[model samples]
Structure formats: C-alpha cells, structure tokens
Target: MSNTQQLKDLTTQVRRDILRMVHKVNSGHPGGSLGCAEFFVSLYSDILDRKEGFDMDGIGEDLFFLSNGHISPVYYSVLARSGYFPVKELSTFRLINSRLQGHPTTHDNLPGIRIASGSLGQGMSVALGAAQTKKLNNDSHLIYSLHGDGELQEGQNWEAIMYAAGNKVDNIISTIDLNGQQIDGSTDTVLPMGSIKGKFEAFGWTVVEINEGNDIDAILKGMAEAKSKTGKGKPVCVLLKTVMGNGVDFMMHTHAWHGKAPNDEQLANGLVQNPETLGDY
Candidate 1:
C-alpha cells in the first residue's frame, strides 16, 4: 500500500479502537478521540523521529504531549499500535486499577505517557519547559503538543504562549484542535474566543492553518510545513479545523457524543463505517 493509504488505514483502525474502547467502558470521550485519529496516526506513524522504546526522560528524540487528555482512548490506541505497549491492554481501559485510566496519568507509569494531562491549560507550559530543557542540553529534537481549542479559555495557556514567544522557544510545535465544539456547546455559543490564528500570531508564534484536520494528506502536508517554519526564532502553531466526530456519520459534527459511549447497535454501526484493518483487540 502507498504511504498515504497506509496512514488512512491506520486512522480508520484507530477510530474503531476509540469507539470500541469507549463503548466497552460505557464511559470516556469519543468525539474528540475520533476527530483526532488522523492526527495521532500520522504523527506516530510518520512524523515523529522516535526511538525503539518508551522513556519518561525523552532526550534526543521527538516528544508529544496530549494536552486534551480526555481523549486517552486515541492516545493509548496510537501508542499501543505504535508498539509502546501491547494492543490487548486497550480492552482494559477505564477499568479499576487499569493503567489506562479515563484520562492519562503518570502515577501508574504508563509507558508512553510523559505527563498527567486532561486538567486543561497546563500541557503547554510543561511542553515549553521540555523544549527549553532540550535547548539547554543542546538536544536538537523537537517537542509537539495538542490542545483543544476550548482549552485556550484557560489563562495559563496564554501565559505559556507569551512565554514561549518572548523566550524564543523555537523547538516546539503546538497545535490547537479547532473543532469549534466543546462539552457544553459550540465554542462560539459557550465562550467565543475570537480568532485563534490572530491570537497566536499576536503572541509572536508562527502559525499554520489546516482546513481539513480529518484528512491524512492534509495533516502530513501541514505538519511538514509547520516543521519547516520551526527554528526561525519563534514557536509554531497549527490551527487544525476538525469535525467533532469525524468517521461515524451519526456522530459527526455534534458535541452530544463528547463524553458519551455508544450502545451495542451504535457501536456496530460505527464499526461498519471503519472496517477493521489491524484487527480488534
């Protein structure tokens, strides 16, 4: 298969993983997880220059932090499929004493998780610190992070934005998942934070826009462009416009499924939309 087709297949399987994981638990975030399947698949499969194994102290290799940790289903699925851990462990997600909690946590020492996220607005600061550390150590690898657009409402993100630009933390590429929908409602209805691209540019970061965040080809091209823009005296930002629930027809473009699990019938329907490519765990 061609590279793009391979990525697309992986994305479809990841979407299936997301739906099955949440449905099995009857709890967990599926909307955002489904929406970001392409991003996760493309990043881990093609973009990152990762080493053979996982380590908390990720030195001399690309690192990624999931700011919107509610979508642990996708993160765990991608990491597992990428060989960070066994894919069978996905069946235990959200179960008591399972390393795969509803949201990612460091307390359990999950192999691929570097930080306990999902608290919102804190991941950028943590990524910045790591980026700065790479700079100090003369490490040349980059740091990447993903944040929900709604999460920008937190004051801490802006502070980190300002800090990164002012201090020239150019080794980080932060992306905002501009799905335009949050838990309560559309971001415009909940709390309209105007012009994410404008705000990032004003903060002195180089910004790129991906109008089709769900498309693997678009993500690959946009991320490559973002990488080219790095090391130019500022951090980079990718404004990714994505649908809340992308692969499943019924779930697409709605916030209702933000944290809801599918029933048996719904799960079956969703799986039909994305045929199992890598086999289900």
Candidate 2:
C-alpha cells in the first residue's frame, strides 16, 4: 500500500468523486459512499494482493464484493482510481448505458465488478462461494466483502453466515459498515440489529471490530488482524463503525443524504471540504 498520507489523500479524492458523480446526476447514494472512502482506499491501495489487471476468474488474486451496491459511487471511484478502468470514465456515472450504474452489474463487462449487488443480503453467499473455490483450488488468496449494517436485516445473510461456519469457509472476510444510519433513518430506529458481533460469534465465525472505520490507520490495523485469522477454521467478520457522509459537514450524522445529491451550493461546499487531491475527473 502507499504511505498512510497517500492513502488518506486518495480517500479525500474518492470523496470528491462521489460528491461530483451524485451531484452531476442529481441522484445516487453519497452517505454510505463517503463513509466507506477510507476502507475502499486502504483496500485497493495497499491491502489486497491484487494482480496487474482485472479478470472475472480472479484466479490467484483477492476478490471483493459489494453487497450494498447502492454505494456504487464509492466503489467506482476506488476502482477507477486504482486503474481498474479509466478515471475519466467516472464522469459517466449513472448515465444511461454507463458502466457505472447506480448498482453494480456484470453485464456491462466493467472491470473490477464481479457480481450484481444492491438487492441486499446476498453478498455473503457469493463471497463464500469464491472462498470455497479458492480453498478447493488450493489457492491461498482470500475473498473480501462489504455489507451495509442495515442490509443485514435481509435474513439471507444469516443463512450464509450459518453456511460459512458450518462448511468452514474461513478464507473470506466480510466487513459490515456499522454507520447506524440507513436510507429510511437511523438503523436503531428503522430496525435494530442487536449484537451483530455476538450473532457472528454465536454462528461460529471469528469477529474483528474496527471502531474507526473512517480512519485509514485504524482500518489498516484492524483489517490486517482480520487477514491473519483467515485459513483457520471459520469465516471472519469485521464490524466496522463509520459515520455516514464523513468529510462533508452538512451530510454527516444523518440519513437524508443516503440517496440525495448535493445541489450546486452544497456541491461547492463539499468540494471545498475535500479539496482537490490527484485532480478531478
């Protein structure tokens, strides 16, 4: 990975990309995207033992799945910035026929996107398949996945959870963004998912809690620990605590911006806060 400062700078730039992409379309999700900027940056920049280019097979490289596909802005920004595709292509986000859809899909043949997401709760099962395949192939590579905390209410995740533990799918690490805020409202108010860690532990999976999901250093440290636990006997889950709409002062601490775009004035404010790092698309 790049130095800590470089990773931070990329994160700031990714935030800018998310804001601009959503503002340009007057649509899309920015809250979750902004909240996960640091994790995306850290993962693509340094963490993954990724190969030179993109391919669906992933063969010997680490694979990542975005269960909460509404956050395509963040995912696209990171993939583009990481050279999976042209950074300039980020300008076409959400436009008709654009590879960068509001939700990720494979039909577009977009690099770095393995499966369609956004239905919520199905990502764990997909990651498990990949992990199990890796193990069968005797490949040491790991599979990583991210899910929205609110998305866990889907029930399908729990089934996958039980399946992973029971089948010993230990080569995968799934991180849940515990931002607490979701589209409808705060997760606590909308649907309380009591004791996510306990639930995972009870299912026989190893758990790693990242208290500062928005911090590069903290995420790197926590993820490193999670990586070490792979190949043991159970899957690993990361309870990542993040803040919705991080970096943008107004967007923070609320679910209002979950799928809303910033207007001209709000966009100006957001850009000013993130500044220009690595230049705009």
lDDT of 1 by residue, 1-281 (tens): 13998888888999999999999989999999998999999999999989899888898899999999998999999999999989999999999999999899988888989999989999999999999999998999999999999999999999999999999999999999999999999999999998899999999999999999999899999999999999999999999999989999999999999999999999999999999998988
Superposed on all Cα atoms, model 1 deviates from the true structure by an RMSD in Å of: 1.0
lDDT of 2 at 74: 96
> Residue by residue across 1-281, what tens digits does model 2's lDDT show?
48999998899999999999999999999999999999999999988999988989999999999999999999999999999999999999999889998899998999999999988899999999988889888999999999999999999999999999999998999999999998789999999889989999999999999998999999999999999999899899999999999999999999999999999999999999998989999
Show where candidate 1 strays beyond 4 Å: none
- TM-score, cand. 2 vs. native: 0.99
| Candidate 2 colliding pairs, count | 1
Per-candidate RMSD vs. true structure?
Answer: 1.0, 0.7
lDDT of 1 at 156: 99
Clashing pairs in 1: none
How high is each candidate's TM-score?
A: 0.99, 0.99
